[model samples]
Target: MSAPQHPTETASTAEATSGAVLSPVPDDVDTAPTELPDADPDSADAVVEPVDATGGADGAGGTDALLVTEGDVAGDYLERLLDILDVDGDIDLDVEGDRASVAIVGAELQDLVGSDGSVLEALQELTRLAVAQSTGVRSRLMLDISGFRAKRRADLTSLAGEAARRVAASGQPERLAAMNPFERKVVHDVVAGITGVHSESDGEEPNRRVVVLPDR
Candidate 1:
């Protein structure tokens, strides 16, 4: 038998009390970058005081501000990460619904994704922690590299669609291979969208998976 997998080490580390701030950015289909004038650190530092807009006693004002600030902090953090790894990329930020979203687009970032995106998941949790520490707000930020996940989601969605069709035709529950939470979520979503099909997650972390069932 294959050895069992463990729960995400970073998931347990998140300080649950901190709130996650997400500000959705309007979609811009173009992923290309436009060059800007070089940054002047001295002038830049003098212009703004970095404060966690997500922190403090502003009450209602803090909510929206916190969302935007989380994006800024996350962008800076991702930039530093790229620098340290000697990778080149453009960072894009947006807040959609209730989550802050960040995407890194570059040609040379495959290493960051790792096999099956295990490394990306770890990096995302760590980045969220960094944002939380800076803004004093827990962030459930979603990070994407080279659109690897976007493509993966599309593929999974198609696979789920096929599985759901087969299950409806065969009238049997589909037991799929084990998948990470993100992948399972994609499958569940695709299957759930169709008529007379239902999906649920079964098992536990790491080994946890989704099972698609025919409607009764």
Candidate 2:
């Protein structure tokens, strides 16, 4: 048997039923890999860094220019993606609070959002990495394609609110099914906004789930 291929390194380059992955390295991005902070040797949790939410206009407590730069980088990267895929689209860039947001609008771009938004998720991470590389700062900029994510967010918000209400009435913690990190964040944030409920993520990735718990 041949050696196994690590998904993280090769998945981005593989061609599946949908579109082939665009170049992971955007042309404008520097060739050098980012030198991220060293992991804490003593803690397994060190792999995760707390999101800087205290700065900038988004409450990140840093310069707004970083967000703007991130937006610019994402916009340029998205334009190239459209060109590479032979699709025509216009990218809109904006800074919502402290995070940059990029949206693609066009009729022919629907395929970019594969079944269940798998492609969109990958593209979002790649875009974030591109921005991070360009600015030498981590970014949480949200990318939206054809309003799929916007609609999904609205749906998830409603679901989380309903779950929160039920949990409050039944006094039972509702464990949501497995979700991606981004989806869990949406559920957690939505539930956290309501009274008498809190959200926590459990399990490992790809199968990790969110549990909406009653406030103690």
Candidate 3:
């Protein structure tokens, strides 16, 4: 078992939340620097602080229009910002469960994804905030750039399977590399499906990772 550490401590002392590890506290050793310029949150992303947009609100249902509204807000914000950035991409919006989802579609938009999709993750947060500001409520909007998230999901699922196999064969724990919250969740889900192995989170944000344990 790894030693537990405070949330503010280094990655070595990291602890897990939700029984699994990983994601952006916006810092950690696993994080890769991106090529995109540091964004100005106060600029186009937050420029529209209007409320009264429809769709999602507090306690929205799965099929609620609120999520769509949230997507619209985020999509509009992203579209305008992309135009300013001179990035040629089409923003697609969808109401995915209780959250709004947005994807920047276009081959030329790879630079927006950055190294290890760090730029995309940061952009996602900004989009969610933009939706919240426009709707006068919090938003749980997911963002994807150039199908990077889709590809990452497939890879993480495979990683979880490999980790499970290793744990089952060794009858020991296997700690995975640091990942983001979304990535960790996918890995945990995969771990839950297999027998004789269980998963737990370790470390802090940005450096937190999943640890697979064999059935003792």
Candidate 4:
């Protein structure tokens, strides 16, 4: 069967449909291979990171400049996709840290955002594939729809802090409910910053969960 049109489509999405997996990991947060802290929206650092070739069901290597190339390719692909779906939205591009970030804004994006932003994640993966196909290199193009990702990051940061506190007080690792790669990364980033607490993934994909560990 064909994959759904959402951004967070599975490893099978590109592998089944295009047979090219971009990120070195099973997914790139769905684009980046390794998860890095998100750049502050108020900050203008290049925040894009390429998919790590060592991390995917199938991985490909790419250069640093390739990150910007991903942004351009994804911008064009998303522009065309919106036209096809008859959605009205504007595309904004940025290079923060070492990654390509693209946002779809200035329109009604609730449906695209979907329940808990699942649709947005699927769409982002598709956009990354588009970039990979165009550049003939794996693309870890980060896609944001209607600012959902920004809001999510803010929420995750808070959630992680709370989880860390619980672990520190109890002196027992607290296991978070299962989360997707992107969500897990958000938690990992926050947990990593908390003194005396660390986080790691434990389990297989889809059911993979994060555990916040306190320094013993």
Q: Count the backbone clashes (under 3 Å) in each candidate.
A: 7, 12, 9, 28
Per-residue lDDT tens digits of candidate 2, residues 102-181?
A: 77766876678776778887898899889777766667777777776666666667677887788778766666666565
Give a tens-digit lDDT track for model 1, residues 1-216: 111221111111011112211111123422121111111122211122333532644454555467667778878888888888888888877765445677777788878887767678878878888987887666766777777667666666666788778777876666565666556656666776787767665556655555666677
| Angstrom error at residue 96, model 1 | 2.7
Error of 4 at 77 (Å): 0.5
TM-score of each: 0.69, 0.70, 0.70, 0.70
lDDT accuracy of residue 82 in candidate 1: 83
- Over 4 Å off, model 2: 1-62
Q: What is the C-alpha lDDT of each candidate?
A: 0.60, 0.61, 0.61, 0.61
Candidate 1's error at 127, in angstroms?
0.5
Q: For residues 50-94, what per-residue lDDT tens digits would candidate 3 score against the true structure?
A: 223343333445235666677778778888888889878767776
For model 4, residues 1-216, the per-residue Cα lDDT tens digits are 111123321111111122111222232132211333441222212233334453232323344456656777888888888889898887877765446678787568788877766788788778877876786655556777777777666666666788788776876666666666666667778887878777766567666666666665
Pairs with backbone N, CA or C atoms under 3 Å apart (clashes), candidate 3? 14-203, 15-203, 19-201, 20-201, 21-201, 23-180, 55-65, 55-66, 56-66
Task: Please tell me which model should have the higher TM-score, number 3 or number 4.
Answer: 3
Cα displacement (Å) at residue 182, model 3:
0.9
